[model samples]
Target: MSGIKRTMIILPATLVYFLVMLDSSIISTAIPQITDEFNSLLDVGWYGSAYQLASSAFVPLAGKIYIFFPIKWSFIVFFTVFELGSALCGAAQSSPMLIVGRAIAGLGASGLMNGILTILAAILPPHKLPRVMGLNVALGQVGLACGPLIGGALTEYATWRWCFYINLPVGALVGALLLSLRIPEINTKPPAYEVLHTAMSSMDLFGLVLLWPSAIMFFLALQWGGNQYAWNSAMVIGLFVGAAITSGLFLTWEYHYGDNALLPFSMLRNRVIYSASATMFFFMGVMLTAYYYLPIYFQAVKGDSPLMSGVHILPSIISQVLVTMSTGTLIQRVGYYLPNVLTGTALASIAYGLYSTFSPSTSVGKWIGYQIIGGAGSGATSPGSYIAIQNSVPRAAIPTAMAILILCQNLGSAIFLTVAQSIFSNSLQNHLRTQAPGVDVQAVIQGGARMLRPLVPAQELPSVLQAYSRAIDAVMYLGAGLGVAAFGCAWGLGFKDIRKKGEEGK
Candidate 1:
């Protein structure tokens, strides 16, 4: 392909990838406004978790769809679904409706993310793939960095509804550009009814059926265990039991299905694939925890406005973006990812430990320095696992391996966010009672961090702030531990040099 033609094909796809990632955390800065508008502060966790759950659940299915259908058409379909979901979110009138919209958008996002990589794999040679993948990951990190800023600007200057509405025009334009592009069809299998049916059957819908509800149940149990109900309550216990049973059934079905399974045993058995997936799981958990909660700390504890909170997070965002782009290039040049992974996780752990020490009186310089440390670590390590897995797998296995990696990343965000939410709420409630005896805990929660100052009595404000600070500290501690665990997981990513592999195409 000519340079201009390649740009046209790659640019739109990268923008679409940016849109999906931007949506993942754009809501972080808007959470306060959303809670106040909907009067459902307790559902804050669900807003993010719903998107993650849907995205993670549909990843394998998306891989199968791409393998069996025309790449360009499959991508267009996914983009359309995403556009519809974005429209729904912009028009939602209630918290539940917004959550539903997020889930729908996530379903489409799963396909777009995997489809973009698959398309690139088809169009680019093995030697050129790393640079393109690196560029793609850098764009993704840029989206991650810019999300809060855009959300904050929209939420403060306009309405939070624009956060979703902004996607409509951009996505529509990108979709049009994608349709006009002449992408080569990677899958040329016969489209007869019988063949289509066979392809669908090979997707293992039963495994998806078993996996989806199990994951939902597990997240529900975690979301509600300490916040909505007692840990030992029948409601929580029943959800846990259901999740366990369904998870076991799903595993058994996948094992029996072997190569036909949504997540094939062959892919799972590869040391590099499994280890990289695990490393990504924990690394993402740590990254999202920081992204979501650091804003809360700034706004709630330090008393910054939404826009100011976004401004404060710039240290981390700038460092993360720069490191992520540079690291991607570095990996391509050096052709080894293990060192970057190790250094990133180590810095992340140290950064999280430092952040855990944040208090109301912590200086600006200290927080900014800590953010730089954490951001650089996260950025360097973010693309390492993906590169490792992509290098290790054959071209034919790229789709499945990519899906597995995406699943781990999304699942980690979902699971760890739930854990952090549970801890934050429980600790906040306990501290509120102990620190300010007469304050109403439910009112405090409903008001969120932004309104806490005005909601509580002036005399009790100090105690409430202290309680919030301590609760956030606990969350940071959890993040620190996750970072340490990610480091250990990276160690298991045994050395495999990609520079030595001969060029091969699917």
Candidate 2:
């Protein structure tokens, strides 16, 4: 393909990715509004977790689907499903309805993201792939960074629903352009139901069944324990036990199914693939915890409006974008990724540690500087794992490898967010009891974070703010620990020079 043609194909696909990522991050700023509307502050984690759970569950299956189906049609179908889900979210009347909509959107997003990367892998030369992939990733980060700003503006000026509504037109345009473009297909099998059915049977649907419930049970256990039930209560314990048993069964099934498994054991054994996935799993957990909670700190604690909260997050976003763009070129020039990964995680650990020290009286300069350090670290390391996996795996395994990587990242987000929420809620409740015993815990929680100032008496506001600050700090401390673990995983990525392999076509 000519340069211009490649650009045309890549641009629309990147836009679609941007839309997917935007939907994921946009809800951060709108969480306060959504919780207030539904009167369910405890459901905050579910807003993001539901999406990540469904997306993580279906990602591997979507990779298998792309391997068997026409890539173009698969992408269009996924994009359409994503649009439908967004429409449902925009029209939702309750928190449960919105969670359901997010789940649906996540299902489609899993396919869309995986399909886009698979298409790129098929079309691009190995030597030039890093730069293009970098561009795609950078654009997605742009969407992620802008999500809070967009969501805040819409929520303040119009309604939180516009956060979902905005996806409609952008998605429509991207879908139309994709339809006009000819996306080359690597799957030469005939496009027939019989073929699809055979492929589907080989996809290990039973394993998917086992995996979904395991994840849902695990997240529910985390979300409900301490808040809705005692940690030792039968309900929470049962859920934990169920998750463990189901997960074990799922692994056994995957082992038996081997190549036909949802996540094939053969691929998992690859050092580069698994280590890189592990690195992303921990790194993303840290990155997403900060992304979701930083807005709350700005709006709920610092008294910024939603729009201003977005503005406050800009330092991190700008640093991330700049680092992401530069990291790609750096990787292309250096040919190795482990050093970048190590360096980035080291900085991330320090950043999160600094963030944990933020108090109600933290200065603007201090917060901005902290965010810049964290963002640069996160953006610099984010693409290393994906590039490493692609370089290590064969073309036929690219879809599966990418799917596994994405699955790990989303799972990290889902699991860690739930853990963070649990920590935040429990710590807040404990601090509130000690700091201001007369305040109603349930009432304060239901009133939502941003509404705390008006709901609490003036005398109690200080205590409430202090409790919130401590809760947020607890989460940040957890992020710092995860960053340390990510750094450890980075060392296991096996020191391969991706550019050298690309040049040799090995």
Candidate 3:
């Protein structure tokens, strides 16, 4: 392919990735409005989790789809599925319908993101991969941060349904661009009919089938462990046990299937693929805490409007965008990824540690500086892992490798979000009970994170605000811990010069 063609493929791949990530966390800002419209908070958790659950469960199968099918048509199909889900979400009259839409979107999202990197791996030369991937990661990270900001703006200025509606035009443009181009397939497989005929054997359909439910079970165990059921309760324990047994079975099946397994044992044994994925797992956990909680800090603790709360997050997002682009360039030049991963995690750890000290009266300069540091951390960390995987794996297996990385990242997000939610709720309730004994803890919890002044008695409102601030502060610790964990995982990512080309895997 020529430069123009590569540019065309790269641009839309990044755009669709941004769209996919935006949908993942953007719901946070719109949830308040959505609940009000639906007149129920009972289904609130599923709005986000359903998308996450479906995405995580089917990601490996997504990789399998890319491997078995032609890249161009497969990508278009995924984009169409995602757009249909967005339409359903935008038109939803009830909460269940919205949850179903999110799940559908998630199913499509699984393919969309994996396809982005896999396509890039197919088209880009090894040396050029890092910088282009850096741009993609930067934009994608910007999309992640901007999700809340954009969601806040749309929800405050228009109906929250517009959050989902926005995906339509953007996705359409992306689909059109993709449809216009003929994407290169890295390998020439047998004809499409023969490929489909033998898909059950080559696709490892049973392994794929077992993996989705396995992921769902693991996520459910986390989601309901301490909240819906006691950790020791039979329901929670049974879920955990089932997840473990099924996971073991999945592994056994993969080992038996060897090179053709959904998660090939040959790749699993690689230091770079497994270690980079480990870093991504914890790295995403840290990144997501910001997407999920910072809005609450601005709205509930500082009494900022949703729109203003979005604005307050700009420092971090902007910083991340710049650093992401820079980091990619630097990694490409230096040919080493470990340093960026280490440095990024360290800065993020310190930034979140500083964030944990935030209070209502905290100086503006303090928060701004902390967010800049956090953004730098995120931008630097984002591209290196994918680059490492690209460098370590052959062109043909990039899809499978990228799929594994995404699975770990999303699984980490799911687990950490559950942990953060548990911590935030418990801490909020506990602090309210202790400091504002007369206030209604349940009512404040249900009120959502906005306009707290009118909800509480004047004498007790300060205490309520303080409680909210501390609860958000508490979740910052989880971010800090995840950053530290990522740093530790970096040690396992050997110092390899990606400038040295990788296997052909032929």
Candidate 4:
């Protein structure tokens, strides 16, 4: 492929990725309005989780589709379906409908993201992979970074409805661009489901069954533990037990059934894949705490409108975009990921550490600086994990590793979000008790944000708001601690350059 063609292919793929990520973060700014329109706090978490859950649930399926069909057709079909989902989300009238729309959109997004990586792996030369992949990561972050600002602006000026509506034009443009690109058409007739059946003769179906449900249970436990039920509630206990049993069964099945499994036992034993994924787990956990809680902090503590909250998050997003692009080029030049990962994590840790110190009185300059540091850390960490894993594994195994990496990342997000949510809510409750003395805890909890709106006379509202702000800051501190843990893991990866110029030419 000529340089011009490579650029053409990469640009559209990157834009597709950017739109998907943008939708993810963009919706955060509109959440307050979404909740009010639907009048469902219980379903609020679902808005984010719905999209993620759908994308995550079917990630493994993308590989199957790719293997069985032509890549170009698969991309076209998936992208079209995803855009349809986004359109439905914009038009949704009820919470369930919205969740359904998000899930549909996620289905499409899963393919777009995974497909982009697959195409990149096929097109980019090995030595240039890291740089190009970094660019991809940066573009994706651009969506994530600008999502809030764009979503906020649109929601504030037009309507919250436009948050979803905006995807229509953007998605259309991306689709048009992708249509113009002429990519290689894979012609292999995948050995029939007959081969899969033959392969499955030795495969572990039990592990397959256990893996997804176990993940779902565990994720649900994380999402629901603090929010819906008390930490010690029977529901929480049941969820944990279910996750543990299913996970145990999955391992047991994999060990006994042996040969062909959803996740080969051998892959797990690879120190590089395991350790890198572990780092991602912690990294994603910290990243997710920010995604889930930052908006809450903006609205509840900062007294910023939801739209403004999204705008405030723009610094973090923008920093990630700029640094991630640079990271790709840097890694390609250095031929190792350790320094970038380590430096990135350390910066993130500091950002989080500094965040722990946040109070209502914190200056905007200080917050923006911290966001930039944190964003850069995330940007650096993001590409290295995938690139390291991709570089380490055989090309054939890339899809499996990619799926596993994505699974781990999303699962970690679900688990950590739960942890942070518990901390935030508990801290808020504790502060309320100390400050108001005789106020009804149930009333405060039940009222959500609305209770404080008018019930607290104007004179005492500042103290109430202060307490909420302190609680949010405390959660951010906890997130910082998690970042430190992730940094340690990244540092331990021990830089190893895996790319070879000779490999790409084959």
Which residue pairs in candidate 3 have backbone atoms (N, alpha carbon, C) closer than 3 angstroms, thus clashing? none
- For lDDT, candidate 1 versus 4, the one ahead is 1
**lDDT agreement with native, every candidate:** 0.86, 0.88, 0.83, 0.73
Best by TM-score: 2
Residues 86-113 of candidate 2: C-alpha lDDT, one tens digit per residue: 9999999999999999999998998988
Candidate 4 per-residue lDDT over residues 90-114, each given as its tens digit: 8999989998998899888767777
Across 1-506, the per-residue lDDT of candidate 3 in tens digits comes to 76898899999999998998889778777775675566533344567767877777778888888888888888888889898999999999988899889989988888898999989988887777888888898888878878888998998998778889999999878888988998999887567898788888788888977787777787677667655677799998888888889889999999999888888888888988889889988988898788778877887788776677888988988888888878988987887888998999999999999999998888999989999999889988888888888887778888999999888887777677767777777778789999999998777766666646767899998889899889889999989999999999988888887776623221
Q: Write the per-residue lDDT of candidate 1 for residues 210-322, one digit (tens) a residue.
A: 99999999999999998879999999999999999999999999999998799998899988888898998888889888888888898888888778888899999999999
Candidate 1, superposed: residue stretches over 4 Å from native: 502-506
Query: Which residue window of length 10 is worst by lDDT in model 3?
Result: 497-506
Residue 116 deviation, candidate 2, in Å? 1.3
TM-score of each: 0.97, 0.98, 0.94, 0.89
Candidate closer to the true structure by TM-score (higher is better), 1 or 4: 1
Q: Measured by C-alpha RMSD in angstroms, how accurate is candidate 1?
A: 1.6
Clashes of each: 0, 0, 0, 1
**Candidate number with the higher TM-score (2 or 4):** 2
User: For all the candidates, what are their Cα RMSDs to the real structure?
Assistant: 1.6, 1.3, 2.4, 3.1
> Comparing candidate 1 with candidate 2, which one achieves the higher lDDT?
2
* Candidate closer to the true structure by lDDT (higher is better), 2 or 4: 2
Instruction: Name the lDDT value of residue 175 in candidate 2.
Output: 80
